[model samples]
Target: MAEISREYMEQVAQMWNARGKGLITHMALEIENVSSEGVRVRMPFNPDFCVDKDQTLLHGGILTALLDSVFGLANFVTIKGISSMATLDLRVDYLRAARSRADVIVNAHCFRKTRHIAFNAGNIWFDGHEDAEIARGTASFALTRGDTSLLEAMTKGKAS
Candidate 1:
């Protein structure tokens, strides 16, 4: 493995967050922090995402998407440049429903990296309660070296 450039790592972080800028743009997810070890993202709450209007519960699928994206990103940052990776498996346990109208934060870490795959785990919590998690998940991704065109294609295809 070659030495990972600090500048390229920052670019990868920006690119990873850009993945969420399309359809999920409404989710208002932002990259809170990034490091070779992990990535953290914040998804601001929107009333339109409420699954239970009366209780103001966020839709479970949104959390799943958040986990999936962060897991892939966690894997991406471990590499040198723009790379392609896909989630092979993702298991999410919703410990509790997220509080609506409050921002949800997710922190995902790439715990293990093999020659062709990366393992990741993450936790989600509403703003101001990072220790009290609402959900946790484990994920694995199939890793490959390539330009970001594949990611662009995937994001565009999903947007359509």
Candidate 2:
């Protein structure tokens, strides 16, 4: 299989960032890396997403969404064309609390891909601590070809 070019992958990352709005935009999510093998993303700490009144801990849902997005990005990069995909299942294990003011780093790998399903695993950690992880997750996505619903929205017009 042909690999995606670095320039093209960078474009993909920018497109993904542009298409991200609402909660993702509000959370300041950024794509740090994209490749056929995996993807990396960073989400800066936001007091609005804090779970505690003191803003010392982040809510678990934020990490789950970030993991799902990163895993899905890994699957998308492997596809040759623009296709529609949905998360079929996601399992996340929380190992520790995410401290406030620290960016959340998520790295995901596409371990396996079949005709219709893509399997991925990911790890989430606070910046500056590679050995210490805040959470880890696995996800499966159902991919569809020739589905331009997203392609059209992303390329031609706004996505609903």
Candidate 3:
């Protein structure tokens, strides 16, 4: 992995938070760690994401969405000159039932990159149980490269 600056990581966090309204904002994700190698994020458990009346079991769809979002952040941190990116393909597996009120922790990284694409893999687990992964995912993204980076475009309010 290439070296990423602390300033750049801070900018990424700010950009993520400043996006204002969207699924990401609704997730209320926190950037626990960021590097050229990958990113780690925490999503607090929300009862609204539960499928049952008891609110113990999280909907699988929410877990999938979390992986997709974190994969994007992984790409953003690892790839350069990316003006935008779109998920070309995504595959997620539920290893175990997500039945806890604990915050979810996800670790994702861009494992490979080309001129126009990136591949990422990640896994998720509850806050304290690293031995038991609840979900795992792999995805590929179509990269749009340009002189203006995604970060710059977003910060300048020019990203769409």
**Per-model C-alpha RMSD:** 3.6, 1.9, 1.6
- Rank candidates, lDDT, best first: 3, 2, 1
> Model 3 residue 20 lDDT?
39
Poorest stretch of ten by lDDT in candidate 1: 151-160
Candidate 3 — which residues are off by over 4 angstroms? none
lDDT of 1 by residue, 92-138 (tens): 99988686577889999989888688889999999999778999999
TM-scores of all predicted structures? 0.82, 0.90, 0.94
TM-score of 2: 0.90
Clashing pairs in 1: none
Q: How many pairs collide in each candidate, listed in order?
A: 0, 0, 0
In candidate 2, the residue pairs with backbone N, CA or C atoms under 3 Å apart (3 or more residues apart, or in different chains) clash, namely none
Model 1 TM-score is 0.82
Once fitted onto the true fold, the runs of candidate 2 whose alpha carbons sit more than 4 angstroms away are: 147-152, 158-160
lDDT of each: 0.76, 0.80, 0.89
Error of 2 at 88 (Å): 0.4
